[model samples]
Target: MFDYSEIRQVTSRDNPLVKQYIKLRDQKKYRIELGLFVLEGARLISDAISEGLRIEYAFVTEQAANKYPDTVAGLMKASIIGTYLIPSSLGDVLSATQGSQGLYCCAHTLDKISAADKMNTVGKYLVLDNLQDPGNIGTIIRAADAVGIDGIFLCGCCDIYNPKTVRSTMGSMFRVPLVDDMDYESVISLLHACGIMTFASVVDADARDIRRVHFSGGSAVVIGNEGNGLTERDASLCDQEITIKMKGNINSLNAASAASIILWEMTDEE
Candidate 1:
């Protein structure tokens, strides 16, 4: 039970917090500089709390605070600073999506582990090489979390904190371990040193069928860009090249779909 009396109301769009939320929502640089990210809706805020993320501030509309009392209570419990009540109209103005839920929060960014630290652990990993789509990145993160992937390695991928990506993750972002912005050579070295075999997902006829590949011990499956697939250098760095077999003229799967299929195969062996 939370004391609703403690919640402060913000009536002006020009309020510093409101202005800050708008900036954090739209600017990646601001997010990076501040070491914070914005999450929307009670569902995501609840997920962040469940994961024990350090929430800095919570902003809710008067209607939402009253309508979703339990959620507001949870946010209050999780918010280290305080919970704020904004007008519903202001929530609409601040939202990135249609039909805003009128619940939002700012939380500290999850700390990323170094490649060396992450690679030392024994488990399956998903590697994204220069993947550009925020939806694909988020979907892959969700899939990885679902299948119990040990970690995700992002090399030249889109910002994981992008609002679209964060929304698409649907809360899985907080549950999974992420390693971002590593170079290929460093990643390959670390993986090999830790006895983790790297498998490149490719569409070429010569690539081995994913069905036949045996996933044992530590392993990583690399998913490339949406449009270009893997670069020659990246593909060559992988210990093996594997492909999902398809019927008819279908030669490719979307990066996220491809990741899901490969993850299923890899995890099924465990």
Candidate 2:
């Protein structure tokens, strides 16, 4: 699919491109500045490609080429600026995960939903407020996709493009529509303008029980941070406050867990 002679070899860890990849992986600021992010694993790269994200650069270890031959062949067909063949040992050193897949690549950030264009006026949506845990963020993204959420608004959350978060999504990130770095007021305003009902998922005992509430219209459930939950002002801004009715005295849940339950209830056709 591509010229074998065109593939470059990087024998030294000191190679400029190697350093650049490492920086993109390690530094969020650098990723933002370069308009690029690094990803590891063959399936993840394939997922990105399937989602129409371009591969700018790729690094493949010899072992990776041998094991994932079909993937390598497909990668050859990709419109990449540079491709490097590295040793397995170096791949191990550069790999973020304990067991390296030996295939890695860099791609520009995916385009996301923005205020410039009004989002869908119908379908379920998720709003994450100040969620700090990358794992939680990624898991929520996966859950949102699984439950068929129309879009996700990430407000004051961790960088969704963080390598760990990206890996945790298990390729779901490529499927789910996302709006990052949004604030509460903007999210509320946008949803209201679109005629979507906004429900704040909170721990308040007096809040309506989520299971009993019928979401008959285009709706959004606002999930809060891992530690503090939502501020009173944010919750009050929503049309209504809802809570999961837990057994016994359990009053709170993990951010991702809460979101999944609320999302399921919100979208439940039964």
Candidate 3:
């Protein structure tokens, strides 16, 4: 096992793993090619270990190394691990965030959901309709896991492997099977062909209150963009539109909040 604590502190800006982490953070293609995604902070690293992901590397400050010694020990066994004693200046160089938690992991990106997995969705499947915000996307993913949604379908949405999205997931990103970057038309066609009842989240007209929408076996729910809401084509594709009743002054809920509400409703709570 590599010495998690004894590894020489690296300060150079050009260290290979440091450069790779930065690239993975900034570019989409590096993440795709390496089959790796980044997870930050102590909580997410703990969660990834619990999920059995093969962590490829971890970059940590001394504080995080001490705080998560056992986790560092485990990751060191199979991974090329490095630690740095980061000053505030160096932290800014390494971290995307102002308040750096001082630790992060790179692990394999999740596998695409296969036909067998698609066929096995006997309950709720969350769908994205070109939803662009990574934070919202990540929160919805975590919510889906909490409510035991069967899988997530990312059609015409932002990349699930985006580091911001991954961080937003808070580790639930590893547990959920995510299918990404599909044609909205083909996705609708496939779901219909497979006999799944689809509910598109929309604002008005011919939509049932989410509370009243009955989700039996194998239902798919679509959540759309942060600003414009679901596209006309996406709304038209569903069997019906489902809306959360809001009596307050807010015209609409945030996409993540809306998705959580809808996923809770879709859960087979019997």
Candidate 4:
């Protein structure tokens, strides 16, 4: 158990650690440079701690401490170095969004499954190609975790540690396995090498209806950007082009919505 005796009270916003938290909260580049990210809200912090994430530093507002004493105490015990009890006003500087929960923490980013050989041969996977929206990425990660996807390959997606993305995952950020740095070509080649059928999700009428295709073992669906859909080259490289059959005039689904559907279909056994 982490030592709780190290908790300190901070009255000034100029505190170096406070500034560090702000940087990690707002700047993705800085987060990547330091290999750390900031998580806001007691629930987010608690969830991370429960996942065995060691908190480098925890900042809790006095108001939050009174409101969530047990959670605050838990943070004290989970923090690896120090826990700062700060005023509500300072919490604003640490928060990325309005109505801040007044709970925050800095933790190193989780190691992802980046090595090619670490991936198995017969597991379900999701490949995101140039999907930039952070919220969509987060929602898809949550969906992937719920549907028991084997892993997620983020090929040119936004920073998975984007504050909005992190919060949007609702703790699934800690649960889902990820490959945040792979390129499209590498992803496709790896999947094919492992004998996984690559399915390209598209809006084309000529594509195979997803309902008719059997999601056999070792399936991976490539979800494209929200606006541009799949690139021509990407679609052609895949084993099959698949589409979710829509009714009436509905031509396309939202990225997150579409991914959820495709993931369910891939995991569903007929």
Candidate that would win on TM-score: 1
Per-candidate TM-score against the hidden true structure: 0.96, 0.94, 0.90, 0.95
Residues 64-163 of candidate 1: C-alpha lDDT, one tens digit per residue: 8877788888888888888898888889878989987889998999976776755545689888999999999999999999998898889898889998
Q: In model 2, which regions exceed 4 Å deviation?
A: 1-6, 116-118
**Candidate 3 Cα misplacement greater than 4 A, ranges:** 1-6, 80-89
Tens-digit lDDT track of model 3 for 1-270: 334445556677787877887888888888878888777777877778778877887766766667777766665654655444444455567676668777777788766667444565465688888889988999999998898777888877777878788888988878877778567777777787788899989887457888887788778988888899988877888888888888868778999989888888888563
Candidates 1 and 2 compared by TM-score, better number: 1
Per-residue accuracy of model 2 over 37-147 as CA lDDT, tens digit each = 988998888888778887887889877887887776666667477778888878876788989899988888887566538577777889999999988999999988888
Candidate 4 regions with alpha-carbon error over 4 angstroms? 1-6
The deviation in Å at residue 126 for candidate 4 is 0.3
Candidate 4 structure lDDT: 0.88
How much RMSD separates candidate 2 from the native structure?
Answer: 2.1
Sort all candidates by lDDT, best to worst: 1, 4, 2, 3
Candidate number with the higher TM-score (3 or 4): 4
TM-score for predicted model 3 compared with the true structure: 0.90
